[model samples]
Target: MGRRRSAVLTVLIALVAIYSLVPLAWLVVNATKTQEGLLSSFGLWFDDGRFALFDNVRQTLTYDDGVFVRWLGNTLLYVVAGAGGATLLATLGGYGLAKFDFPGKRAVFAVVIGAVAVPGTALAVPTFLMFSRMGLTNTPWSVIIPSLVSPFGLYLMWTFSQQAVPDEMLEAARIDGAGEFHTFFRVSAPLLGPGIVTVLLFTVVATWNNYFLPLIMLKDPQWYPLTIGLNSWNDQAQTVGGQAVFNLVITGSLLTILPLLAAFLLLQRYWQSGLAAGSVKE
Candidate 1:
């Protein structure tokens, strides 16, 4: 009976694996083929003739007046500025709320929770109007400012702070003559490493994938990120008949995913450690 059940589970897992990998397999196979080969030959297999993969990359970079590179740069800037700033703000605000007792504290926490429940898309129009009033639209700030205010990130930090940080440690630091800010920096922040990393990872992915906000805010193509750039390529593909942009689009998609993969792999240790830390402590 045990062997029979194991065999059945193995088959089920195999089917699930194939379902997940089939699309990725198709993408890799299609990306290697030329435009002619893509349309002419079986898509899942390689063709007799080969076009240089380097050439495709070159064309993708140089096409549309080399705007793709600009988009890549813009994406990096947004992730670093928006995500980095949001993570910092969330950490500070969360730590304060968790440790300090002051007037309107409950009100502040309630407001932050309410903000987290609100969809970012619902606020986009209002944000645009406010930015427009300040004459900040069509600029990097329009995107960066919105990305910096992440209520979910704040909530994550608050939860982490409440559980991960100990009151005894804070009291010890206070008795040692460390001021509140100094104690937080020296004592609390070091222990909150996992939470900080968690917030950073979440912020990075959110800023990287953001589209509608940038679309409504940015009119200039030069400021476009990879999401918008690839979309434009897809839109123009129909008009440019016989063009190899389909392959370029696939290649661009692969390139866009590479950085995200690298980031997650590099930060996986911290993420695991954070989860373990939280569970073991509380």
Candidate 2:
């Protein structure tokens, strides 16, 4: 009975793996095919005599005067600026909330927790109007500024600080004549490394994948990030004259996913450390 149960479990796991990977496999296979092959061949199977992976890449870069590269640059900018700022704010705010006590601290924390519960999508219209009033709409700052205030990232950091950082160590640092800011920067920051990286990774992915904010804020196609750019390509591809763009859109999407995959592989160690740190006894 034990052997039979094990065999069934193994088969079920294998089936689940296949189910998850099949779409990704189809995307990879289709990305290598030319427009004609993409249209003519089975999506999951390779086409005969038509491997245009390089051609697709070249055309993807060359399309509409190489606008895709500009979009890539914009994406990198937004991700770095928004994620980096959000990570810093989350770390500082969370650390303060977790360690320090002051007037209205409970109220502040309550607001942070409430903010986390509020759906970001629900705030889009309000944010848009606020930016519009400031004459900041239709610019990169419109998308970036909103991305910087990640309530979930702040909540994650607060939870991490509570679990990962000890009050005793902070007290020791204070006793050793380290100013609060100095101690936080020199001591607690280093200790919070895993949490910081985890928060940064999460914020980066969130900003990178954000579509609706940019869609509502940005009016110029030149300011579009990969998400909006790929969407524009998709829209254009529906027309007869833009049929060839389908291959480029798919190829660009494949390219867009690589940076995120690389980031995960590189920072996965910190994520593991973060999970472990949260569980470690002081």
Candidate 3:
């Protein structure tokens, strides 16, 4: 009975893996094809006799005065600022909530939980209006500011800190004449590594992939991130007399995802440990 159940579970897991990987497989295969070949060949198979991967990449980078490169830079900027800021804020906020006791703590928890329940799309319009009043619309700050608040990241850090950081350790640090900042930097911060990396990965992915907010906030093509820029390239195919650069778009997309993949591959160990940290308690 156990062997039969194990086989069934293995098959199910394999199916799920295949299902998730098919699109990525399709993207990889199609990225190698030329515009004509992409239209003519089977999507899952490589185009025969005309491998355009290098050419497509060159064109993607050099296209329209190297706008794609600019967009990539903009995306990196957003990720570094918005995502980095969000991770730092979430860590500090989470650590505080986990360790410190203060007035209205329950209220603060409720507010954070409520914020987490609110979808970002629901807040977009209101945020746009507020930014417009502040004359921050069409600027990078509009996107950066909004991306800094990660309620989910904060909550995850809070839970992780509760388990990962011990009150007794903090008391010991305090007893040793260590200041709050010194203790946090010297003792608790080291212990929070996995949680920090977890939050960083989440925030980086969020900021890097953010589209709707930047779409609504920014007007300048120079400030457009890869998401919106690639979207614009994709949209070009829809307009009358528009040049169809689908090959560049596909190549650009492949380029865009490489960083995220690298990030996951590099920090997945920390991310996994961070997720499992609070689940088991002694």
The clash count of every prediction, one per candidate, is 0, 0, 0
lDDT (10s digit) by residue, model 2, range 175-270: 999999998989788778888998889898999999999999999999999999999999999998989799998899889998998999989987
Clash pairs, model 2 backbone: none
Candidates 1 and 2: which is better by lDDT? Answer: 2
TM-score for all predictions?
Answer: 0.89, 0.92, 0.94
**In TM-score terms, which candidate is top?**
3
Q: How close is candidate 2 to the true structure, as a TM-score?
A: 0.92
The C-alpha stretches of model 1 lying farther than 4 A from their native spots are: 1-20, 240-242, 274-282
Predicted structure 2: lDDT:
0.90
Model 1 CA lDDT for position 273: 79
With a 3 Å backbone cut-off (N, CA, C), the pairs that clash in candidate 3 are none
Q: What Cα-based lDDT does every candidate model obtain?
A: 0.87, 0.90, 0.92
Give the poorly placed runs of model 2, Cα more than 4 Å off: 1-16, 273-282
lDDT of each residue in 121-186, candidate 3, tens digit only: 999999999999999999999999999999999999999899899999999999999999999999
Q: For model 3, what is the error of residue 4's alpha carbon versus the real structure, in angstroms, after optimal superposition? A: 3.4
Instruction: Give lDDT tens digits, candidate 1, residues 1-282.
Output: 999999999999999999988877777777777888878878677767895466667877887788888999999999999999999999999988888899998899899999999999999999999999999999999999999998998999998899778999999989999999999889888789988988899999999999999989988988988998898888877674836588788777777877887899988888787677767664
TM-score winner between candidates 1 and 3: 3
